[model samples]
Target: MARIKPQALLIQSKKKKGSTRVSLATIITCNILVILVLLSLYATYNHFYKRPTSQLGEELMNTENTKDGGAVKKFDLPGYAIIETSKGSITVELHKDSSPEFVDKFLDLCQKGYFKGMLFHRVIKHFFIQGGDPHYLRAAEGWTLQGKSNGQLSTSLNSPKHEAFMLGTSKTKPNAKGFEIFITTAPIPELNDKLNVFGQVIKGEEIVQEIEEVDTDEHYRPKSPVEIVNITLKHEP
Candidate 1:
């Protein structure tokens, strides 16, 4: 208006056009941001608010099984037995809901004082200690039989896995486990998913180590005996 130069007027026009373009871009960007926020809210609602327990259950469950899916139904197990080895004492909790038949068979043997004076017959250093075979029991003067005829056997495809408590398991052979419990010293990854770990040793891990160190000939039977004075079931609930 004040007799602006022609060049200056042209520059002013360009500046106004640039501002219009910037304003349009800002509006478009804000609209996009709003849309993203709405989509996020919708997705969250669909995933959490609208999802059912059945769906959530699948995520938390360890196995693909649903409803009597071989999962421990009781939600919790009872810590009941104490295996006091010469090295120390180990506590074990039993799972009836997960494997009541197995637990009962083991408990029956314990109640019978079957493990008294039994040697930890087999030892795989840093892997496990397997006993429970009546073969090692100091029975007056005869070989002890191991089977349902004289003793119980585990037919489970996978032994209940537990790092705390030792458990009896099989290795491809039928009725191969009797009074045998192996302690997992290292995490055996190959055994994962394929084996069922049932118990863990809460105490007396040192005993397991001590038992492992005992010099063995060939069968892993300790030259010296690792005796279980007695295994008493405590706090069944």
Candidate 2:
């Protein structure tokens, strides 16, 4: 075997050290890149699926009350409404603090008997049941109301999420909602910020669920007519 010289040995040791350093540097870079990718993925998951409730609360708080200089109204006590339907009655607690204008308009319509004998014209399983359309009520009389008393409420809280048993108003135009309202049977996050959530079912949630189970056509109109006999509002003392 040939004996290696000291200089050649030292040069070989230096080459080994250089290769080791390069390998360590490459490993550290790869580890950093992996960590960065994991962090980005976590952020994306938090943004879409696990968004914090505080963020949702902030959005609700930031909602613009567009009632045109009308002061934010507050109820002395929580108010509730009894929705007498063909199936059964559902009681909803109005969120006056969060949606005063919506609650006010709804109560006004109820007092005016606008929803009397109105059909739950639209219903979707695991989604919602919509009613309070005067057009449908008038249609039963062989004519149409042409959207009379269908005035929209401008100041209302946008529904950030549609929780089960929540009441929401339909938005026909930007930041405007009319007499059409709905009750949710499931969590519908897609309806967030699209509809105005004004109340939540405090009693007879089962009745709302029963309504959803009703058979409907492709257009979601109930096969058997489901009518709103009347809606009565009561204030809690």
Candidate 3:
């Protein structure tokens, strides 16, 4: 019935346009948030849910590619094992016959990616670098069968006999062989034939000494963290 002022109409139109722009911006922001949530869900599923089963059949390869890898030989049992660390490496001789079950179990853990993110948990300058406890893994608890007998960490294995103590720590008390191996920084004359000597460091004792010489607290853990980044087992052809 009445004519509206042109100036007032222009102002009203501008306000309507500004409201439209705000609505569009809000929608765009919501969409972006939704996309981010989806991406996060996918990443979580990929990491925690999926397992890379293809590597099982591909035969172990030498990832270290050094003397550590060179000194390894194929023994009657699995021989020439390599543990490449960020700090250094320790190549061990697997005891197939003497410590058959435990040795194979240890190698099995190495076969999987179990040792990759694990660290040399306990380092007692002269005692040894005590690792192999599942607690040291990045995310341990939920993990199934990480080479440790029983679900927790075992400090001892069920070896009927004992061997040289200086070779490594077997914790022969009763039950203590989950995954802990100690490198002798200082020779202990007492442990020579009392503990089960499974394997020895054919090479890389220098790295072993470095691990042994680290300063330790009352708990015997090094003041610094030494990681065992990789492990490769070389079998005889």
Task: Give the backbone clash total of model 2.
Answer: 0
lDDT for each residue of candidate 1 in 1-237, tens digit (9 for 90 to 100): 579999999999999988756477889999999999999999999988787888776655434444675654323323577887777787766655566666766777888887888767766564556666655233211211222124323333353353323554433333544445556554443344323455666666677677768898765567887877788887651
TM-score of each: 0.50, 0.56, 0.49
Residue range with the least summed lDDT across 10 consecutive positions in model 3: 139-148
Per-residue lDDT of 1-237 in model 2, one digit per residue for the tens? Answer: 999999999999999888756577889999999999999999999887786888876666566553648766322443889999998999888988788888878888888898899888877666677887655332222111111123222123343446778898865442333377778776665566456799989899889888889998766678999999998888751
Winner on lDDT between 1 and 2 is 2
Top of the candidates by lDDT: 2
Better model by lDDT: candidate 1 vs candidate 3: 1
| Cα lDDT listed for each candidate | 0.60, 0.73, 0.58
Quote the positional error of residue 147 for candidate 3 in Å.
26
Candidate 2 vs candidate 3, lDDT winner: 2
| Model 3 residue-pair collision total | 13
- Candidate 3 yields a Cα-based lDDT of 0.58
Task: State the displacement of the C-alpha of residue 57, model 1, in Å, after optimal TM-score superposition.
Answer: 33
Question: Positional deviation of 69 in candidate 2, in angstroms?
Answer: 32
Q: What tens-digit string does per-residue lDDT give for candidate 3 at 148-204?
A: 223332223333222112334343432443555555554433343433456666778
List candidate 3 segments past 4 Å from native.
1-77, 134-177, 192-195
